[model samples]
Target chain A: MIKVEWFYWLCGAIFIAVAALTFADGTNAKRYGSGAFWGLLGGAFIYSTFVVHKTAPASVLGLAVIMMALLVATGQLGRGDTTGPSRAEQEAGADRFGNRLFVPALTIPVVVIIFAVGLAKIHVGSEPLLEKSSETLIGLGVASIVAVIIGFVMLRPKSPLAPLSEGRRLLEAIGWAAVLPQMLATLGQLFVAAGVGKQVGRLTEHVLPSGSLFGGVLVYCVGMALFTIIMGNAFGAFPIMTAAIGYPVLVQHFHGNAAAVFAIGMLAGFCGTLCTPMAANFNIVPAALLEMKDKYGPIKAQIPTAIPLLACNVALMYFLAF
Target chain B: MLVLLGVLLVVIGFALRLNPLVVVTVAGIVTGFLGHLSVIAILNAFGNGFATSRSVTLFVLVLPVIGLIERFGLQEQGRRLIARLHALTTGRLLVLYLLIRQISSALGLASINGPAALVRPLIYPMAEGAAERRFGRAIPEAMREKVKGYSASADTVGQFFGEDIFVAIGSILLITGFVDTTYHLKLDALNVALWAIPTAICAYAIHGTRLFLLDRRLDRMAEAAGLTTRPDKADAQEAGR
Candidate 1:
């Protein structure tokens, strides 16, 4: 019967412990790293709980506090030596082109333009820009112009973007990973819209306690976590699992508050994210970015903290959601 | 069947190592066709996916900027900076990066691509420099690689745990909608995000600890290999002679 307030205090204590640990061994870089990691986890748990109670915008602010604390603990934003580059390293980084800023810069606009034109045409909105052939052409024309302008500026022969000849290779390396989110998101949407969620609801109804409110909350949260591990992106697994099990069964049948139940359920999904490699953004990207000798470097670091947090999340959902 | 076809195209394209854009485009087209969509419909879907998630594409813009910074000796600068800070260690630097990454992500700015974008060209070298300064010489290539590995891991842990706290985030919204409709329960996006806090905390602490111990582990491994400072001392003696 631990109250949410007690959980908050415990979270604060975790942060204090982390800060104390850092102060004790701040001079020792390794010890500080360890302290910051633990501190951040404890802080994130407590902070997120507070945020969940607040409005959406406020939650963002809360996240900012967590980031600031982390930054201070890690010593990145704090006082330290800020030196310039060596001549050799600079030369290596340099190219005949002005700089390598073209790739990321160009990527943003390209992605935007593509999205704009697509959204307009899908008729997903009330007003479809492509209602007439002329409008359709006009939309295409605008997108084309934007793309061309960005391409010209960023990819000019003598521009710094010129050195991005390796762009093709880099994209290739990222390969299917780049499209995974889109595919998964779509899959989630389809699962929800197709009555699959309803089917799952029917299946779960018979197995659980008829009116045990706590049991329902526990099932909802734990299920979401397990689904996230399987699907990688919590977003992907959310629709199918929630629609099938959460909505019709937990909220409607059991008479739970929609907002509290859904929000808490998603949080549970994220717990699974910490432990699984399916979430490429979480598991795969780190391995690729770090070029780690071991592909499991991120997962290995995540397990100890992820397990405890998962337990905490289940507890919160049971207590608070109910 | 359309979905299956689309899936097959993606698998084949990837296996063949075809240009990813082309492969995805082809897959999308196949999916659209199988689903009885017109050519325009397929294209529109592609555009729609990109538009709604415009934030995801922001990373593309950041990559070039990061490349530019790195080109100007960002990594070298980071290294020299770390070398001068006698108290700084590789573990501490990485922990700091993890915090920044996690916090930014939680705010729904999950596009904190700088570390992943800059690590290869900047952070890795900087870490190497710091190790060299502390140990009184350049670290071996294996150890240098290990530093790179840990730095990237830190970023992933931070972002993964942090981002779910934001209610408006696509992941949170998606989760909320799913749970409400499926379980026939009324759940709020805030509740899901609120519950995420503890998990994020756990992620930060556990990963932070690993980063802290990383240096000591490397040192032990290096010592066990019996390839420690003797080589450097020998090189110094030869230079002196």
Candidate 2:
């Protein structure tokens, strides 16, 4: 059965390719720094494939993470000047391709849907075709490869190296911000393993006044959001908040519906995600991807909606959860 | 309380605008140390966490395809398509995307859309194109930045609230599993998933209204730029000229 490991290998190869391209680019003054950063990331990806299976020691991967961090911390990472087509060429290409240009771009979502919903369960004599643990991620890997091939058939550039070069350009444009998501996810995990949640849970439980349902609901929703902001993911914050106040205070004392309280409570945590750069994937990465002048642009845009939605969540839990 | 020192470090580091990676690494180490973990154990946590979380960064795989198509003018095509549909304002277009993203995610199709795959390459251009067409001139840099922000916001809000209503989603399973195992309460995943609908609808109404208000903001920006009062006249004038 195809597993998620192969996809990591593919990404490792891609990162290596990007590193090679960076090394080859003479225009970037910090090419070595940038190249080393990507190269380290590439090695980590390949190395992680083994680490995940317990085939290798994880400490090496840990050491690599610190080294990559040092590279960025010291102002080593920088972008090359690799660019895409000129404005006139983009216009001409658009006119030439017309609606056809959308085919490969749109295929990603359509094919992901097909594989995720339909092909995920199919078996070849009892071995699942896709890895059960990560069918969606595997589907994403497959969809991207198919999309790139389709792009090649349609665009037909002079060099087969076009994809790598262009991908490198975009990668450099994103710079260190691209990896921030994974790094934050790592931070979230560390937060969990460090018992940070336990500390916070104890504090919240102490602070709450007993038998006040509104106070219980308010603290549960707000604590979930606050803890998620600290941890960078609602998933990490959920069990802590639930255990501290949700189960004992709200559900047991007030007889709140587990479904309504917890479901809306998670959404409340999402509100914190909108407001925090710690939730880098949803906020910071997008700002960088869109090439905005301010990295916090997405976060600023989200706060208005997040605040109101969070208030609504509090109201929903108070009135409906019981 | 002392174990929460890492949390305090994070808040201070971010407030001071230090390098996030460095801040995070230090914070993790300090947190681990306070939690009484050995060096090897800390390293193990770091490595294991990074490895397991690889799924978060899988958008890297799609980069080559996105980069290649972009070089061949995928964004230009999006712009041109939006330009031709003059009636679809930026707000209306984004509201439409919010609905699409929300509904599609509700059906267990969250993987189908994202910042790298859809928003940067397709949605941002279309929204920007709509803004430019509505204003009948190049939009100011600030307005363009706002457009980008709104585009990303729509995707986030839609995905965050919408995906929970799908019973198979991890969040629902987590809710059910935790409640059932911990409290010994028999909870159905469907029941948990179904409760998400009201908040989902509230998210749509709240964010959908914000998006539509964005159109009015753009109109005010256009008027401040001394463009024609009516967008149609501005369009006709640009064309006739």
lDDT per model vs. reference: 0.51, 0.78
For model 2, the DockQ equals 0.36
Candidate 1 structure quality by residue, lDDT tens digits, A263-306: 65766677777678766655767677666777776676566666
Candidate 2 local lDDT, A177-283, one digit each (tens)? 66665665566556666777567767876787755788888998898888778767676567667766777678877888877988899889989988999888889
Measured against the true two-chain complex, the DockQ scores of the candidates, in the order shown, are 0.10, 0.36
The candidate that wins on TM-score is 2
Best by lDDT: 2
Q: Is the docking of candidate 1 incorrect, acceptable, medium or high quality?
A: incorrect
**Best candidate (score: DockQ):** 2
Q: What is residue B188's positional error in candidate 1, in angstroms? A: 8.1
Q: How do the residues B90-183 of candidate 1 rate in per-residue lDDT, one tens digit apiece? A: 7777777677667766644454354555555555666665566545465566676677667666666676677777443456544433333223
Off by over 4 Å in 1: A1-194, A205-218, A253-264, A280-282, B1-87, B126-148, B166-168, B176-198, B213-241
- Residue pairs clashing in model 2 are none
Error of 2 at A31 (Å): 1.4
